[model samples]
Target chain A: MPEKPDRNAIEVRGVRKVFGTGENAVAALATVSVSIRENEFFTLLGPSGCGKTTLLRLIAGFDYPSAGEILLYGDDIAPQPPFRRPVNTVFQSYALFPHMTVAENIGFGLEMLNKPKAEVKARVAEMLRLVRMEQLANRRTSQISGGQQQRVALARALAPQPKVLLLDEPLSALDYKLRKDMQIELKRLQGETGITFIFVTHDQEEALTMSDRIAVMSAGRILQVGAPRDIYDRPADRFVADFIGESNFLKGDVTGTDGGRATVKLSSGTEIRASLPEGFSPSGSVTVVVRPEHAQLAAADGGAALQGTVENVVYLGTDTHFHLRLDDGVPFIVRRQNARGGADSFAAGSRAGVVIGGDAAQVLRD
Target chain B: MASAEEIARAADRKDIRDRWLLSAPALIIILVAATGPLLIVLVYSFLTSAAYGGVEWKFSPEAWVSVFLERDIFDDTLSLADANITIFWRSIKLALMTTVVTLALGFPTAYFMATRSEKTRDLWLFLITIPFWTNLLIRTFAVLQIIRNEGIINTLLMKAGIISAPIQILFTDTAILIGMAYVYLPLMVLPIYASMEKLDFRLVEAGYDLYASRWQVLRRIILPLVKPGVIAGSILVFIPAIGAYVTPSILGGGKNMMISNFIELQFGQAHNWPLGSALAITVMVIVMIALLVYVRNTGAASGERRG
Candidate 1:
């Protein structure tokens, strides 16, 4: 056998998965396509039941696509069994064998191949060290804590040095503090291992913190695939803009277009201009997405520019958020830092002025 | 002038008395039903036999010595002593054979049932238990019908022209084994199924995901996980098979005389009560020793140290 060239770790082309037949059929993935490069930390972020984990299984060879093909390192792997494929998965449950010790669990695959006893022992020891669980090597799975068991599971999966690692909500079982800590550890581990990681999660914050590139999915379709900053700063449509992070959607109509910029007239009778993204047309109903921190609040008696009344106010230690209702009754939220004496301090139940510029918002054409 | 400590002690005594009162009736019944017979068996094993076939006032080891020494005091041409030893050995061998066969057939069937969908598993479980629904004697006789000479098997063989005369199938060790295994197969399956069903299948999948072959997953992960079930099932089948009397009697047709048959003969036809009691005592001791050895070798008792 000849050694193959380095290629994309996983490539999925037009994959479709239908759960049942006839009247009960559900199309879980519809012509979904993406390629995960080697050594990249890629996330498939979606809401629940969005076919993200299904896509990961398809790439790992645990499932077969009803209609398209999957390739591992440039060779078609759609027909290969999960064991034969050079991919390992960290399941959501951490599925460690309850009867085996931590060492035995880590060395199971090597022992399965009838490797030399000394070699298996050495590899198991090395993996234990890698996961910082050397002291727990002899402990039975039932004796360990949840986070420790998770590390043991990860060591077992990574011991084979697979070309790709698939993680399906592996951190969902941990506590909030542990989950946050593990996320950073996982990102660092991925960088050190340098294997392609296709992570499936429904958490947007986690996805934003860890991924090199993310594929946002909805209703079994890939809405956008780009760097985290691109997906967050320049979303493709209304759904992508609202799903990735908090955005105050202002319903408006496109008034004019100049190059890549568009001026839109809001239903509140305020004209806000924003730089339109590539291929966005001006002359139809559109919505502008403004981040809360981008809008400023000013006192109504100061004769400030945009007019509104403070509906609600929340002080969050670092910043204060004001919910402003304009004359047209359209609610907009504005966030301001609690700086000593900068500007624009409005009290609740008082009139306020909201100011937003073109660069602070993005026009979303649905 | 009672102190607080005295009052507390009185209350504690009352609580203990109340608990004992609640449990007394059930405990008394258990003692009568279980301990009474056991104590009688122990006392009878040590006592000397009276000439009129009742208990003697003297304590003696005469019965134990005679059984262990395999003496033939009667010195008749057809010695009952020789027959008893032969029957005891035959029974042990048949029981061992039945246990092995049952485990071989039952383990995989249990695994298959455990891994199936709930509805299909229940249907298969029902099918496995169908033969057990009939009386054990009726089922043993049904085996005799199938394998006896001039029976269904011999008739089919003759019609197929495979043999010149009816082959002798019953009245042999093979017939007794088949009957015993058929009767005890369900006993073996249920325990194994319970254990295999509790196994976490994700562990097996994890084996595969880590690049283990299918055979490796089965041998290393699945087999170890279900070992408890196998041991439990084997004990369930073997212990009962050793004491089984009706199946061998009907199917063996007097050719395969096990220990129970000899005990039955000593009491029923031979009119020797001392020897029958001796044989029963010997069988009980042997079963106890076998159970102790099994528990030690399997480390099953140690595994239960948690609870």
Candidate 2:
């Protein structure tokens, strides 16, 4: 279908992939569908074997969905092979050609496209510059370090100006400092090129740092999709809240709702007010999800709170974590800002009262 | 009591002595078996061949000259009608052909083996090596039965109405080449398979991701990467095939002589010790040169790999 390049870059519709047959069957992805906007830095973030990489491979045409279609610019490209697709992948291993020089590796895609030699040279040079690897253009891949090889892999993929660039945990191989630097570089690259990037990663922080939007996946399904702040602020379920960051869940039943807030009655006869997520009914079973940083150890005089013994004290550099257990056998953790003497004020086995603010806790459907 | 430093030094010395002792047996065997015979060949190549089979122990260039030039007893002139050079060139030609055939047959099999599932790959590798367990001569003899007149292949073809008579395959250069290639097939396949098995197919995926067609990927990426293994396997086949004595004599029916058969003739039938020694020394020199070239190429390839 004829369409503008600025249209939706990718639309994976009801895609499913099963790896084997009979007793050994593995459903790598199941009826997963998402729309990735053109020029958006989209990430599929999940733990390993969560089907994020499977979806990326499907988009890049390295793999085909067992059912359903993947459309590129409104064209169903599910039947197409990888080389025929408009998408390129920076593989997780950086899979740079060992025998070729960095320049040759970068030019390979352009040459495969049958571009004129001069234009190929110009584009390769531009890619090398974009990756900040001009100095390493002549070096063979084996002569370079892992970080340099990573840049070469990027340049090689970007040389042909593919409409959609797929990256599979490209920073997983880097050290902490290099990963930090690359996260920034990747955002800049995505911005400058305005190419749709479907990046697959298992790192929540990396997804938050680089992506315009992220789809959190688990057990071969997309749990939620939103901007980083939206995901961190309002997780859709217990899994999303727990997977994204540290969160404490208190199993409760919603007792009442007023205006936009919900009052959930905990099993221990304590009640906490939380904003009810849409589709959650009053008087139904719900889980109140509170980020550890949102709950704090309060003074004994604070009203309407759960009092528990501090089971463990962890003095993190910027924050101290209190692992608390209520007398009813419910365990939860509280993270507070370690300002001056604020930390080390609570000793293990000491009694502490934790207050869960209505604005800080979220009511999840499940 | 000795100081700690002195104690450590003594321990280090003992360790060094132990290391030497561990390798001493193999080293002594190599010296006696390899270097000792090589020395005899070097000396005997320079000395005169007696009227009999033994060396005369006198300085002479006759044996060396016989490899390239022949004395004209009637006209006192040197001509290049030497049978030794012909046999030498014939051996090189046969070895080259054998190497080419083995590579053509081996590379695809190795690639096929590499692509199989791990358990299937083991089975195929074992099958490729099965021929090696049998003696080379016995295996060649089996091939003779298959290709010879009134042999199994001919009987099958005749029974199937495909041929009225057996084709003239035995006792030909083609047969010799077939025998050589068959003998060296495993040598070629094993190394090429090793390299193919070690290949990072992720690079092949990367190639396709970068818009390379399957042909382009195979030619530009797979071919260049697997060349090192092919070269290694080629050397393993070529060097041994160049000095091949049994295959040609059996397959060539004692008439189609190679340099090795000529060397044998000089030592046995012709009873010329010095000429035989010279030919043996020359063959060794050629094999050594081939080895140096292979090592140089492999060294450069590995250096590039380190990049």
Best by TM-score: 1
Report the Cα RMSD per candidate.
4.3, 4.2
Q: What is the lDDT of residue A174 in candidate 2?
A: 97
Pairs of colliding residues, candidate 2: A141-B307, A142-B307, A143-B307
Interface RMSD of 1: 4.0
Per residue, candidate 2 scores C-alpha lDDT tens digits across B1-307 of: 9999999999999999999999999999999999999899889989988776888979998888877788899996889955767788888899989999999999999999999999999999999989989998899998888888878878999999999978888998888998899999999999999999999999889988988999999888998899879888999999899999989999888878988888889888798988889889889888888789878977887677445
Give me the TM-scores of chain B across the candidates. Answer: 0.83, 0.88
Q: Report the first chain's TM-score for all candidates.
A: 0.92, 0.94
> Across residues A183-275, which tens digit of lDDT does each residue of candidate 1 receive?
988987887788888999999999999998899999999988988988888887889988987788888888898888888887777788876
Residue A122 in model 2: lDDT: 95
Q: What is the interface RMSD of each candidate, in Å?
A: 4.0, 2.8
TM, every model: 0.88, 0.87
Q: Mind giving the per-residue lDDT tens digits that candidate 2 earns over A1-366? A: 123244688999999999989999899998999999888888999999999999989988888889999999899999998999978899889999988889999999999999999999999889989999999888888889888888888888888889999999999999999999888888888778878899999999998888788999999999899989889878988788988998888888888998768888887788888887666566777778888888878755466478788999988888888899976788889987878755387799888888887688888766
Off by over 4 Å in 1: A1-7, A255-261, A269-271, A275-283, A298-307, A340-344, B1-23, B42-83, B119-132, B150-167, B300-307
- Residue ranges of candidate 2 with Cα displaced over 4 Å: A1-6, A255-263, A268-283, A295-317, A320-328, A338-358, B1-28, B46-52, B55-59, B159-162, B290-307
Docking class of 1: acceptable
lDDT of 2 at B188: 96
**In order, what fnat does every candidate score?**
0.65, 0.81
In candidate 2 the C-alpha lDDT for residue B27 amounts to 96
Candidate 1: pairs in clash: none
